[model samples]
Target: MKFLLTSGGISNDSIRNALVDLLGKPISESSALYIPTALYANPNGPAMAARLIRGETNTAPFPDGFTSMCELGWKSLGVLELTALPSIDEKCWLPLVKETDALLVEGGDPLYLCYWMRQSGLADLLPELGRETVYVGLSAGSMVMAPSIGEDFVGWKPPTGGDRTLGLVDFAMCPHLDHHDMPDNSMANAEKWAAGMPVPAYLIDDQTAIQVVDGVVDVISEGHWKLFTQE
Candidate 1:
């Protein structure tokens, strides 16, 4: 399985071009799959919506975002609604992902996303997907792939308690490294968090990506890609 870790959304032309260069073809050639953990535009919506008596917008417009990602040349197959799966049967999911060529995980709160991933069986099934196809991960998507989410950026507060991730990748990744919009301490905090894991951590700046193919990870980018592996 191959993995692409981007610092942020594919909103920039350079980043998009870099993705094409790394993926080895246009997204149409790849079976694009997008995963969303949080979709609301409003930052405070989740907690606020939970308290509303009725008609609260618990779920945001996910398809719109999916379409946007596709416009960038991604063949977005579906957004795995981690929170909405218990009502469905499991036999229906594996085949869907197994057939895809690539899987994209969009950005959001890693902690909150991880919370839902555990609630659903998707976390357990991701490694299987990895072994079979390519995995493209953006912000939160990159974070969850790691052993733990880093504190380099703002994170979500769980409704109640903390949640553990599926532990697919050995290291934690902090996407959007050196993004002008992020606070200066983001990388430092992430590095500190990773120190305890005793595993390598990466700070990937925008327009940069880490490509993992057949278990061999190579840094591919047009900019700085920092790696912190404690020997």
Candidate 2:
């Protein structure tokens, strides 16, 4: 699988170019399914989540301010909404996933998103998607792809869901590193958190991305990032 995991979603030209490249085509020719499942998370869940709710997350068409990412100077973007996993069937979202050229997962609450991703069966279905489809993630969107969601970074703990992610990547990512937008996210905090994780942990800022092509990892960024592991 291929991924363009950004801290703040397409922040600059470099990130945009990478995303377009990952799409294997111009943004104009490709279509994307914007899954804002993370935004739909309970706002009161975590500290960073609360700040997110107050920030760009409240924006329309995408609570996480998807205008820049979706606009991509390209084709149209579609929104996928599912309030309750059990209430909705696969037919409602599967067909849309099949037609899109990419999947744009927005940021919010990782725990909240995971619950629905699994409950709706999308989690299982995601691995089956064709290699041609790009998996673009922003903030919590990117974090959920890791083996587990570390609460120390965002403090957004699930009321009931487990920390285990889709495990698409072996490393746990702490997005928006040293970002003033979210005060809770700082270099000091992230480094401290990364030290304790079982797997490698990457702290990436808004201008940075953790790009994964087939299993190889690359840190693409215009800002700061750190990869911490037990030596």
Candidate maximizing lDDT = 2
lDDT of 2 at 21: 85
Worst 10 contiguous positions by lDDT, candidate 1: 58-67
Q: What TM-score do all the candidates reach, one by one?
A: 0.73, 0.84
Evaluated with TM-score, which candidate comes out highest? 2
Judge candidate 1 against the unseen true structure and give its global Cα lDDT, from 0 to 1: 0.61
- Give per-residue CA lDDT, model 1, range 1-231, as digits (tens): 667766555545565665676567787776666665553323754443232212122332222112234345555566566776666787777677778777767566777667777777777776666454767776676777776564443356666644344467776676666555566636776566557554688877765677666667777666676788876
For 45-65, candidate 2 gives per-residue lDDT tens digits of 344333432333444333332
Give me the runs in candidate 1 sitting further than 4 Å from their true place.
Answer: 11-25, 40-68, 130-132, 150-154, 157-163, 185-196
Candidate 2 lDDT (Cα, 0 to 1):
0.74
* Candidate 2 Cα RMSD after full superposition onto the native fold (Å): 4.3
Candidate 1: clashing pairs of residues: 7-176
